[model samples]
Target: MARLNMRRCPQSRNPSSEKIIDFYAGDYEVNDSPIEQVKLTVPITDNPSEPVLTFRTWVLGLTSCALLAFLNRFFSFRQNPLSVGPVAAQIIVLPIGRLMASTLPTKVYQCPLTKWRFSLNPGPFSVKEHALITIFAGCGAGGVYAVHIVIILKAFYKRSLHPVAALLLAQTTQLLGYGWAGLFRKVLVDSPYMWWPQNLPQVSLFRALHEEQERPRGGVSRLQFFIIILVSSFAYYTVPGYLFPSLSALSFICWIWTDSVTMQQIGSGLNGLGIGSFGLDWSTVASFLSSPLAFPLFAIVNMLIGFILVIYVMLPIAYWTNIYDAKRFPIFSCETFDYSGQVYNVSRILNQKTFDLDVGAYNSYSRVYVSVLFALNYGLSFAGLVASLSHVALFDGKHIWQTWGNAKSESEEFGDVHTRLMKKYYDPVPHWWFHACLITSIVFSLIACEGFDKALQLPWWGFLLSVAVSFIFTLPVSVITATTNQAPGLNVITEMIIGYLYPGRPIANVTFKTYGTISTNQAISFLSDLKLGHYMKIPPKSMFIVQLAGTIVASSFCFGTAWWLLESVENICDKNLLPEGSPWTCPGDDVFYSASIIWGVVGPGRMFTSAGNYPEMNWFFLIGLLLPVPGWYLARKFPTTKWLGKIHWPIILGATSKMPPTRAVHFWSWGAVGLFFNYYIFRKYKTWWARHTYILSAALDAGLAFMGVFLYFALQGNNIEGPHWWGNSNGDHCPLATCPTSPGIKVEGCPVF
Candidate 1:
């Protein structure tokens, strides 16, 4: 194993310093060349032979995986859900790794039945091992969204699914994506230009942890700075998180004009555009668009533009203009309604025997209607899908083709330093390995779908078709996410295809959609982790084994947690049935249920066909298909004008993507922070910005996760309520924030219990 030389050269500290020696590339002028600019010169080879599959790795990995799985599922049920993203895991796992490295027994522990022996203490806790642990934790960090199938069946529909059957469905849906990701490693992971910029922060943190280096003059050490910030943040959150919940959504405008519904519509953070509202909670700001502190400046700007156009301009115009009779419905709601303005009676339209749509009942009842925001969400989703495909082809197609041609060639000089380093280890995981995983996953999925009491009702061929669609969309969406942090989701396209193919069965439609859409997302996530492993120089075979094991652990824990929560909480998705201040409101399930009704039950034919009530919605698909052509043409024709390249339509459409769960306040505040830090401060202090930005983001996330866990167990878990006061109440100070203003629309006064 080659040792990484740590001795400092003159060029190591500053890129612009004179008489600088280039360690990686041959000696060259210090003047900036975009391709030659090196952000991280840290050597890739750092104890390549260090033990990765040690007792410490397994113990920590399994513990964190289970903890994250539980926490993610627990928070998903909250009214304002908070995600424990990969960054949080990356930050929190560091000290645990270091502590274990120092304290764990060094003696090799041998398996009684086998010849294999593994040590608990891997010398000094190598960066590669630390990264592997983080990867394992990340695998289970997100609650399986496919579990929504089980949630809706039991909670809202009052249908029963055996625990065994539900667990199998959840596991199959989650792991299918891993197989897809393995198949696409060549394009998404191996290619140098697919930077996966989001991983840079973690890489930087890894270096900060493992590398032997002195702190800058008068500046705080990374670990010291991290601890200080984490402590302060954890203490501060106690106010908005528990004692003063009203601070989470402070709408001064609504407070001033309590009787004016128009003011509330424009000012309320929870129920409207939230133009004047502000959130004190860091979790609220970071929930929708990830932490502004972590995003690249340009990406943040693109998000801001899209958010303004969609939320501020498009949404308000549609609502005030009474498009889809928006005034009759709540301005921002995921719930579907009948034409006569009542909660949609899905039971009346669902055939009890088959769980399929009853055409007679659907026709006899009034036509279904959606809020203006909901209608726009579909249009944007459609437009975003087309835009992402076009953007990648026009901009990155040439580079992709060139990389594919040279992928296997040893003489390829265009590869990045990380790629070059990885090539030294010739033992690549063979293509057959990935193929085997895919085939096995498919076989098991067929068993789950066909074996059990027709729970999913999706045919084997439908499963195969969903997989094929996932394969097709994987490369394009992966390219978009690699270059830009955003992923144009496959929800619209998947739903459209399934709706047309298997029309009347809601369960079958969502099940197919889950396989098609969630699988692609999982593939992208897995690929991102692979990129992380690549950067850290973890052995490919080891990475493959650990990732597989982690997924299995995550699936088991997720199933157990979901089952427990559903059994414990009464009327999980119903606000009226649960206690008034209970945090068990399942908002995510509400959205999932609505989607099943719109696309699965009513379906594309009844919703957008000529004889349908919402026939005009059909134009959105056409509009989306043609929307990106002009932008692609202009950018291709005028390649020198760099400003034209900044316009990414997919990102713009993604801004208003999930309105029910996210508010305009999130985008506005997030963009403001990004503009100040990522754009302005970054330009002025490049080195300082590079050093502190990611560290700050990690600290904030870790602090929130730690505090959230403590609060949940201490107060929420034991059913201990905080002192009842105006500050601790649910709403912002104003009671009439969501009151109806339109004449003849009966006003439901805001309840202030």
Candidate 2:
């Protein structure tokens, strides 16, 4: 079973003690021959030799797609309808694809499949395979959170599509960048200066594949990887579930004295001894905190902005309005619209009502709520967008031109190299074919999307509107995603923009009015392109097909699974019934929706959108918007800083905004996945097989999520509608529940005591 190994060198240091195992066991080297150096160069399309290479492309494509799909699913974080499927494209999939490609003779061309004789071997896999894997992984990883999207689909599109299908369809929208990523990779990745922190895994994996055949052998390292997988799998599968149930909620433990202690000292108080460990997946707090990696830079600037906005801006305004008793908290929910019946219950009101309020609502004077701040933020963000764009062009025009110019040079060379590489190491799928496939897919989706009884039928006008908005925002959205990988509060902004621009139309209701908008197919295709540019190293022309194929596969499977989970598992989305204190609950909705509304209506203005109102986004957005400039300015200002200097700002800001200092588990988990793997598993062991650990982790998580969902059912006596674990309080005064029960009653584990 062990494919690679090693023995100690004769160095005098400690002979046996210095057990240096060869990590690059399966890699090949170009030094094998002069011809090998040029193996990647295919003949021009018009040349007689073109046919040979075309076939080879087919084989590589097919193989790469299949293996990647399997691995992506195998290593995914959650089997939920919306999880990002794979950890790294190049690390696991590309290496395996390259290994398979190595077996062919340098001169070989297309596979024997006569159906498409002129086509290259299609490589071992099609672009479809890779795209499908990537899209599904991303959606599966993140989709579960947006279950309401599925609910909308099922409630509206029941005839033609089920709830699960609707959920997948809604989720697929997030992947839209993949389709156009190839066209924009030059703007995103090829720029030597743009490291794209998130895409690092892709770079590593692709580079490994480009290595030559017979470079060296290190089987022992592979064996070590195998051992680690088994050990980790056993530990994760058994220990976390049975041996130490406490570990399941470890995130609470890690924050006990730190985050909780501070809260308690402030008189917020704690319910019990929290687990407080670094990483038990406490969705409630995790959603609010910046990601561990994006915290460092974000924290400093964000804290400054947060202090200014909360203390000086919103707090002062709040005090003057008397929205709260002496406490600095809001009197009502900033998430909802209606605030009529429960004026006395301040906490309940604050958790449920819309935050789009006039200053009068802030006053104890009792003013009717109005969307005053919302309009201001909406206006400002539009201004910010224009200003941001102009600033970029003004500041980075030369850099942009220079980057594109270099890309032009590389582009020409890439064509030849791509052709040859297709023959040698990959499969080439033509752009035209992919385009045709996409068109056909659109037509098919439109028909299926119409739904029975027209439950999910989109008005012709709304359909046109979504398409227009999608297209208009496509490039800009891609730019933001490629660089920052975040666009928080933007969706709410988009909704408001759309709502205002095209007044009185329920575009959100387009799930039924026009299922086409959220069908997941188009987005999957788009995300595939983004991924192709980031990872696979496939040429832009090739990405079209790659994304198209992936969309078809994922859309088919994802939708089905979503319908099953939602219909069978009742109230998973019910704010009160779901995980208590979790971000999935009603209160957490305040954070996301309020931020979006604030940004959407206020448009980054002084009241709702600026550093004074929403400091996190205002600071993070500004930093991200100015990253290219600072990166360039710093490069010039401190010429010596290079990676350390220009990068320090973006990385620090990104790390801070996304990752906070308090999140040790997030730090450790990422450190293990990104840093540890790169440094130890990828470096010390030197075998791509070590990548299996990611797959092992994903598989374990998927199983756990599935079991968790099932156990939830079991605990409720097979009643899917039963109360949730952890925060239900068994009917006791449930914190922030819609029905305000007294502290004495016991509803389940959620008791009033």
Candidate 3:
């Protein structure tokens, strides 16, 4: 390789420091706005000789991976689950990395036979090395989506799955995404337009961790600021975490109207519209949607609009009017219902042997009806998926098309300054590696489906179709996730598709959905981390290797942890059987089970048809399909209506996607905090926003994580419940929120209207 015209880092950070970029002076200049902003945050420099996959990197990296996998998977069983992502607290770990670097021997030795060399401690822990470790952490930190299949099947449905099948399912679904990530990395990772807003926070934290910056006079440095906020977050979490858990959701209206069922239903943030309801706890503010401080302002606005429209405007009207017999059930719940205003007993309708729906039993018992909120979520999901596709195709189609062509030709020097540096110094990960991964995953998927008593019930063709659907939707869904920090899930679409085709097989429906949706989800996760690597200047192959290795380790641990818990903890997911205040309620798994009942046992054919109550929900598909068109035209028509261009229908419609586990208060508090930081604070204090915003997010996440783990082990783990009084008794002092409104309907604890 010859010495290239790659621009070196200038001594000063200035716009005029950029030099010799030929392509940007031409047609692609339109996309440079976002790329330019990225330059403001990511340093346009690289140190290629730094040893990335060293002894400290692997040991610390894999240790973090295994522990996080165990912690995340273990905590997920709790009613209010806590998930700590691997991206948090790079700054906090700087000392540990340094300690290992200092203590370990610096001796380099040759292998006994082969021409191989190794070292216990390489040079100083470089930025590249630390970034690589985080990548490994990230791969293990996330819960394996396939494990959800295992839990719901075994725990909820009481079905047995072969261990081999479960392991294969976990790995295939996870690795399938690797292929997609590699394919799209050129456009998604390398391209500046796909800025991947989520990565910027991690990037900010990385720079703060590794780079040395002189403290401003009379002002704290980034490191000092991070320490202060992290400690504050740590101390504050104890109040809500253990001492007074109800502080998590403080709805003043609920406090004011203790006796009124209607008022409580409207006021309860845990299960209602959450009007003027918010939280004092950082966990509550960040629940389901990590820290809202990282959410982009445009995303915050769009999601807020969608959330309000659904929760306040649409739901109140429907629930009050008894639409879908809403008054008979909780205003906000994942529970399915019968016509007599009772919870639907799915066991009575399912065949014990086949685990399929017994038609006669189902018909004789009652039609399955979800709450008004659940019904609307279904409708909105139908809209959100297509809305994403339409929005992406309409807004970003031309750029994607050009990028695809450029990637194929293999001659386009298409990337911002970061991509140019990577291309100049390191070997790009070969496309064949990802192709091999895709092929292997597909082959193993077939084996898992067929080799084990046909337990999965999905045919070979069904598996192929699921792959195609995932492939088709990955680009659009990923585009949405990249820009907005939220992606509409493919689970609903996949379940809906398989339900109609292969009805009465609940296991099969979930399996199909798992394969289709999880693969796409994993692909997006991989691409996000890759973009982080892109910004940090880690070699692409090293990142890929760590991701794959960490994924393998994490998948095994998630499966093993889940398997052990299921065996040891009797009556684990059974809420009625478990003792009061037991954290092992498996709330998210309950939602997954409810979905199985709706789409698999009863099936969409029966539930989403004219004979069913939710026939109108199907119309959302068309509504969402066309939702993006008007925005595109109006933005073009009114050139000066700049905000119109930013109004993304996909994000707006999918804003409430995480609702069942994530209640109105979660969105309410998250959106408020999001706007305060990303919008108001950002515009008012640009430099501070860039420097401290993401650091604050990391602090809250890390602080909450460390405290939650401590609380569980030191107190809750020993069956020693903290002091329980009025302040800690209930989430919002609103018992009647779960009550039914119909005259004769009776439910436990809820007032009868």
- Per-candidate Cα lDDT values, in order, are 0.75, 0.35, 0.82
Give the clash count for each candidate: 0, 151, 0
* lDDT of prediction 1: 0.75
What candidate 3 gets wrong by more than 4 Å, as runs, is 1-37, 87-92, 411-413
Q: What is the TM-score of each candidate against the true structure?
A: 0.93, 0.54, 0.95
Clashes of 1: 0
Using TM-score as the measure, name the better of candidate 2 and candidate 3.
3
Estimate, for each residue in 1-753, the C-alpha lDDT of model 2 and write its tens digit.
223445443321211122333222343212111121112111111111212223333444444344433332322212111122243332244444445445544443444756433322324533333433443344333322233344433332221344433543443343333433434445544443333334333222222233222322453332243335434543453333333333323433323334332222121111211112233432222223323222223223323343233323543354345331212222113332322322222222221223222333334322222222222233334434443353445445566677677666755332222233333433434444534543443444354345433333344455445545554444443343344433322343344444444322221333321232232223433543444443333444445544455444444444445455446554534455566533222223233334323333222332333323333334434544554565556567776654523132222322322211122233334333334443455456533423333333333333444434334434422443333454322111112222112233333322242
Query: Compared with the true structure, what per-residue lDDT tens digits does model 3 show for residues 243-272?
Result: 888888888888898888888888889878
Superior by lDDT: candidate 1 or candidate 2: 1
Clashing pairs in 1: none
Error of 1 at 363 (Å): 1.4
Winner on lDDT (1 vs 3):
3
- Best candidate according to lDDT: 3
Model 3 Cα RMSD, Å?
3.4
Best by TM-score: 3
Model 1, residue 198: distance off in Å is 1.9
